[model samples]
Structures are given as structure tokens and as C-alpha cells.
Target: MDFSQLKKEIIEYSKTIGIDKIGFTTASTFDELRNRLIRQQELQYQSGFEEKDIEKRVNPALLMDSPRSIIAIALAYPSKMNERVTSKKGERRGIFSRASWGEDYHLILRDRLKKLEAYIIERVPEAKCKSMVDTGELVDRAVAERAGIGWSGKNCSIITPEFGSYVYLGEMITTIPFEPDQPIEDQCGTCNKCLEACPTGALVQGGQINAQKCIAFLTQTKGFIEEQYREKIGNRVYGCDSCQTACPENKGKNFHFHEEMEPDPEIVKPLLKPMLQISNREFKEKFGPLAGSWRGKKPIQRNAIIALAHFKDETAVDELIEVMNKDSRAVIRGTAAWALGKIGGETAKAVLENARETESDEEVLVEIERGLAFFK
Candidate 1:
């Protein structure tokens, strides 16, 4: 097929597959993208992966063994409901980052991308393509920008004129030598609103974000959070929306989250008392399919305890004590101790003292003493 005919067919096929934005680019556009990945790794933005692991991302060929073109796609994830007010206050509620309110995007986007890949194979037969939805080694946002899907905002999120930054990104690496789109100029001029609005100052002067300091990253992390950073966690149990919420460009835009994406009311706004009382089995059953499930029960339970402490809800002291004293997970105990300190009272003080006596974990012991000092 001629290049002009190929581009037209590709765009039409992508739109038919439910993607709001589609762009194509030569795989070689990643020459500098590799350097940026090294920089991000040095800055500790990538949590699970090491610097060497990210080096592999620079090679599009590594993503699909032999990639000549990148077909980047984006799906808008609008939030129709006022997610902020969906849950009542003081409930040990678990708020799903709006991205995960309904059916998992991985399933939806992967299915759609698979259909598109099948279509390409049928047309070109020799056209080899691999589907990727925020997975694999390709730098999706970088590819998205090269494909003209959108410019990367100061917050490092892809921003399209039609949907802003509230969208899911996916890509297909293929042997098809399609025409590439030039990246649009960045529109984030002199606006530090997203940076200023960060509750924990995760965003820096440039578009750099210290994800280690990001509340979104801290909350979802599996283990005991450092005591100093605990207070900054606020009420966010999963992903944080502060940066997106503060962006002026997103102002007045209508949200339209799919019906299946709506968060489970129980998951959205769970009662603290019940949350503290549930067993691991119950936690797994409730949050298994949700984004929060990846970290397991301890991190979430810890966040709930911290929320109770933040709200100064002393009523949770007894439940927190039970977990601190008896729960097998050291992370949960540490969080309970942290919460007891935040919600100081006689019961909290006594529990703190008792936990300090028997706790062997150095981190949990430190949190225990911090709780004890709060009551003193």
C-alpha cells in the first residue's frame, strides 16, 4: 500500500477500535528518549525497576524484537461523578484513583489493541505487530508525543486538546513504515499550579517529579512508610489526583467515566471501624480487581489507619490496638502505631507502650515510640 493510503487506513482503523487519539512515528524517534529514561531512573522516579532495567526501554526493537513504526493510542478516562464527595467523611473509605473506578483498563485497552493488531495482520499478512497498554519496554508517553497524540504536560502526563491529561495510553510496535507525526509544542506556559498544588511537593521547577516523595507513590507502596512522610500522605489510600486537580487546562471540562468504571461504593468509602476489623481474606476479596490490590492489605490498612489519625478519630484506637498487638504483618502494626500517635488518647498511649515492649522490628519500634510521645 502507498504511504498516503496506509496512513488513512491506519487512522480509520484505530478510531474504529475506541481510541480517541492515534499517532504514528518511526521507532528511531527514541534516540533522546533513552537518555531521558536514564535521567528519570537517576532521579528515582521509577520505583520497582532499576537503572539497567530502564535502559531496555530505549530500544523499540526490544519491545517487539523488530519494530519500525510506533502506533500510539490514547483512551479518555473521564470522571462523571464528583469523586471527591462520593464518600462520607471519617469512613475508612478506599478511593480508587479515578483511572480504576470500573473495569480494569488493561483488559479493555488490550482487547481493543488486539483487534487492531488482527486487522493489520489480515491486511499486510507480513505486518508483524505487538500490542502494549502501559506495559512492555516502550516509553508510551514519549511515543505518544512523537505520534502527535499530545504534548507531555509539566506534570509528565499526556495532554490532548479533546481530553486533556485524563486518558489511558497504549501503543503498538509494528514493522509498518507509516508516516510519522511531529510532536505538538508544549502548552504548559508559566503555569506552576500543578506544582504548587502538590500536597507533598513531588513536582519540581521543571517537569521533574520525585516520585519517591509523591503521595501517589508513597500510598501505593507496600511496606512501612517513613515516619516523616506519613503525615503528608493525607487521606489518599491509592493514587493521588492533586496534580491533575490543580491543572487549569482541565478546568470546566466535563467528565464521563464509563459506567463500569464507577468505584464500588464500599471500596470508595469504607467504614474505618469495619475496615480495621476485616481479615486479610475479606480485603483480598474486596480489592482484588481494583488497582489498590497490587500492594495487598497491609499498605491499604496502614493508609486507613493514617487517615483515622489524620482525622483525629480516637474511636479507632481499640481496633488499631488489636492490629498493632496481634496482626502478623509488621507493616500493619507500624501503621497502627503511627495512627495511635496521630489520634492520641489514654488507650492509644497504653497500646503504644505495650507494642513497644514486644515489637522487635526496628521500624515498628520507632513508630511505637512516636505514638507514645504524642500522648506524653
Candidate 2:
């Protein structure tokens, strides 16, 4: 079987299917990434969303039988929204990171992978392939790096020369022996922009992050956000983009290649107050299609409350008061209490004082007290 000719065919076919970029690499164990995962585990810096078994994450052989190579594909997303949301004088809005702007990337990437796999199978009847997006055991960034799709940036994102860091990556492990592409040279030389721009200093150093402190990670957490990082979160409801936005390489690097990648400005940057009261059905109808909605409406609502406080949006005071007093979830109730304090006014202070008396949950009470402290 002419594997070299087959590989060339796959490359040309990939372009016709809207895959922005494709690269190949031998399926050798990722020794460097394995060591880094161990270090991140030791430091408790992992987001806990990653696969716990570090071995499975670094070795492609474990994921698929006799894997000979990995095929990495990138889909570029738009960095700038075509339509911008206009915030009224008293209205406040929260921004979802660029990643969560459009249809969930996992589904989009998985569809592309399936198409690639079928194309490969048509050529080589016996070829076996395993495909994965972000949730899979295999680290997508590491695979992309080895496949020469991009260099690992200081922000811990894969930065392709053509698309910068604003690209969604996925990979397929195949039994076909494809020649590996050379890894790109790291171009973030002495550029501390990403590290310096990190809101919580989550970028501990170049190409490393303390996920625990990352606003992007924190926004996904189901629990209460740590006080130190709450103010830093600002109006980000889903993920943070400070690191990527700060990188010089990503400057003016906006691509609107795929129609599905286009964002609805109103949905991505919705009014902060409406988010607090959105019903389960309404939440699903509106945000469920976006990747940011995977965590459900609670975390986004909690962050929305925090964002209202960030802007000190006096108009949201009434709604925040209702959430503090009546919300079923302690995290929401507590975060709303905290936000009420941060956006203090006579009414906000009064609601906190009332919630302090009626709030039964111990954590909620603590937040109520914390909120009241702002008035003093």
C-alpha cells in the first residue's frame, strides 16, 4: 500500500472539507508533556476537568491499538464579532470568551474528524482510527504541537502562524504511518505580554498556568469563586481572553472562515440582569447551543452577579436582591449577596441586612455578612 500517496490525498481532501489546517506526527509517547502533567498534578494546578490518568493523556497507543501516527486538525474561529452589543446607560453586559462565542466546538470538531476518518477508511479498508476533541483522554494541545499545527504559546494556547491562538484543535490517531511534520519554533521570545496580562497571574510562567487561579477555569467552577479572583473576573461570564488578547501575535488575527463559528452578539454579550432571572427552559433555549453552557446556567448566573458588581450596576440591584433572598442554589444566593454588597446602595445594603436575618445556609450567611461589610 502506498501510505505516502494516501497521506498526500488525505491532506488535499482535508482542505475541501473546511479544515483550516492539518498536520501529521508519529504516535510516540509524549515524554515532555507527561512530565509537565506530573508537575501540574503535584502542584494541584490541574483544573480537575482533565483526565486523571496522566499516562493515558500522554500516550496515544493506549487510546488506540497500534497507533502509528496522529492527524491534527485546526478550525479557525473569529476573534472579533461582526455585530457588537450596545450597552445602555444603566444596562450592563457580560462577555463570553471567544471560545464560547459560537456553536460548541467539541461537536464541530468531532464532525470534522468523523468526515476525515471516513475519507481515510475509503482509501485504506483496514486502517483503524480514533478521534477525539477536548474532552478526550489525549491532550489536544500536545497532539497539535507534535503534529506541527502550531507552537505552544506562553498563554498555554496552541498558536498557529496563520490563525494565532484563536483556533479549535482536534486529532485522530490512526494505524497509517504518515511522515511527521516538524514542530514550529516558539515565537513568544521574551514577550511577557500574556503572562503580564493574566488577571490572576494564572500564567505562572511562559507556557504554564495555575488553572486554579485562571479566570477561564474559575468561571467554569460550580462553587463559589474565591474573593481574590472575583474582582479580577470583571464581566467575563464564561472564559477570560486577557492572555490571548494581549499577545502581539494575535493582534488583528480575526478569521470568519466557518458560518457556524459566527457569534450572536446578544447571546455572547447578554445583559447582566436578565441572566440572573433566566429560567431553566429559557437558559437552555438561549445558551445551550454555546460551549459555555455545558456547565449549566448556575455558574454563568453567579458570574453575571459578579459582573454586575464589577460595573456597580445600580439598575440590577432589585434583581440581585431577589436572587440573594429567594434563589434555591446556595452558590447563586451567596454570590448575589456578595454582589449586592459590592454594588452597594441604600437598597442593596437593606437587602443584605434582611438576607442576613433570613438566610439559613451557613455559607450564604457568611456571604451576607461579607456583603454588609462593604457598607461599613
Top of the candidates by TM-score: 2
The residue pairs in collision within model 2 are: none
RMSD vs true structure, all candidates:
2.2, 0.8
What is the TM-score of candidate 2? Answer: 0.99
TM-score of every model versus the real structure: 0.92, 0.99
lDDT of each: 0.76, 0.93
**Model 2 residue 97 lDDT?**
98
Worst 10 residues of 1 by lDDT: 85-94
Residues 218-312, model 1: lDDT tens digits = 88788888777777776667778878877887776555534445656567556666777677789877777775567687677778787777777
Prediction-by-prediction clash tally = 5, 0
lDDT of 2 by residue, 176-198 (tens): 99989999999889999999999
Where in model 2 is the C-alpha error above 4 Å? none
Q: Rate residue 280 of model 2 by lDDT.
A: 96
